[model samples]
Structure formats: structure tokens, C-alpha cells
Target: MPFYDYECAECGVFTALRPMAASAEPCDCPDCGTSAPRVILRTPNFALMEPGMRAAHATNERSTVSPKSTQAGHGPGCSCCSAKPSSRTLTRPDGSKAFPTARPWMVSH
Candidate 1:
């Protein structure tokens, strides 16, 4: 059973659980017992939610519509996206460095 909204003339608005087949029909108000027409004003109430929960809901909704891109080359100077090979020099605390590559004549800066 799903919750449905019904507006009563004397009791304002109230919600009731009913089958999908009877969603279009009016439901009896719990307080007044009067038959009230089904309404569409029962949207999710995010205002009463906690700050963190509300923010998470907002982030989820945004990601579903316009998610952040994960493709390469987000902008200039991106280390992983650069074409040039990165340096692999290992240095010690005394400022001395060693190159592990096969180049024997390479000079240290």
C-alpha cells in the first residue's frame, strides 16, 4: 500500500494508505470521517530534514540530472593528463639523489 493525500473541507489535508487501484477515488478523512478528494500536494517535505541529510539529498538529485564529469583532461597542468613523462628521481635527506634508470651518464642537477 502507498500513501495518498486527501483534502477535507473541515480538516484541511490528511494522508492515507490505499491501493493503487483506488488512488483516484476519495478517501475518508481520519478526523472528520468525511470523504475527501485525492490531491497531489503531498510532495516530500525536505524542510524538516537535518542539514546534512538535506544536503545529501540535494547532491543526489543534482548528480542524477547533471553529474560531475570523470573524463580525462579536466583542465591545463593536470599531472595525470600531461603528455610528458614525469620524473622518478629518489632523493635522500642529505639532498643527495639517485636515478634508478639505465642511463649511466645522466648528470644530477
Candidate 2:
């Protein structure tokens, strides 16, 4: 089941709920019993891999490398052209590096 976040306009309170598909049509605030607006909430997620799992997966994928690399068109020896490097290094305008990887692709604006 998926959890949904809702906020009550009458009482200005937020709550989470797991409702049946039909029940979600007219969800009511638990506090004031008024209709609450459903809001999308971000939830954290993770995948656990045992030792050597990552390496094993990478090894298997490399066996079928194409004759021409997909990134070859970008540039020779370019970071983006290298087998989609394991991770990206970011440098700020001030010439200082931060975080191991580039900013997430889907960050909220």
C-alpha cells in the first residue's frame, strides 16, 4: 500500500494515511473532520547489495560492450565518454569540490 500526505485547510494540520482506492476520493481530516487536500510527499528509498554484488553486476555488463562506445561522439577522453564513469565529481564556480556525485537529476526547482 502507498502512503499519502494530506493537509486540512480548516485546522491547518497535516497527516498521513493509507486509504482504499475508493476511500481516497473524499478523504477527511482526522482532526477537524473537514476535507483535506492530498499532497505528494517524497519518501526515501534504498537498495541493499551484499559484498561483491556491485562488482559482479558490473563485470557481467561489460562483457557485451558495443564495438563503438555510445559516448564516443561527445569527445575523446571526456568524462562523459568513459563508460559512464562510476560516479561524477562536481566542482563549484569557486574552484572547490563538493559531494561525490553531481546534483541529483530530479531535484525540485
Q: Pick the candidate with the highest TM-score.
A: 1
Q: Taking the tens digit of each residue's C-alpha lDDT, what string does model 1 give over 12-104?
A: 999899999999999999998999999999577789899999999999999999767655347656667668875788788999998877388
Which candidate number has the best lDDT? 1
- Which ranges in model 2 have alpha carbons more than 4 Å from their true place? 20-24, 47-109
Overall local distance difference test of candidate 1:
0.87
After TM-score superposition, the amount by which residue 94's alpha carbon in candidate 1 deviates from its true location, in angstroms, is 26
State each model's CA lDDT, in order: 0.87, 0.62
lDDT of 1 at 54: 99
Please give the range of 10 consecutive residues that has the lowest summed lDDT in model 1. Answer: 69-78
Candidate 1 lDDT for residue 94? 100
TM-scores for candidates 1 onward, in order? 0.44, 0.35
lDDT tens per residue, model 2, 6-84: 7677776465656557435656888878888776565423245664876676666686674345554675677753666
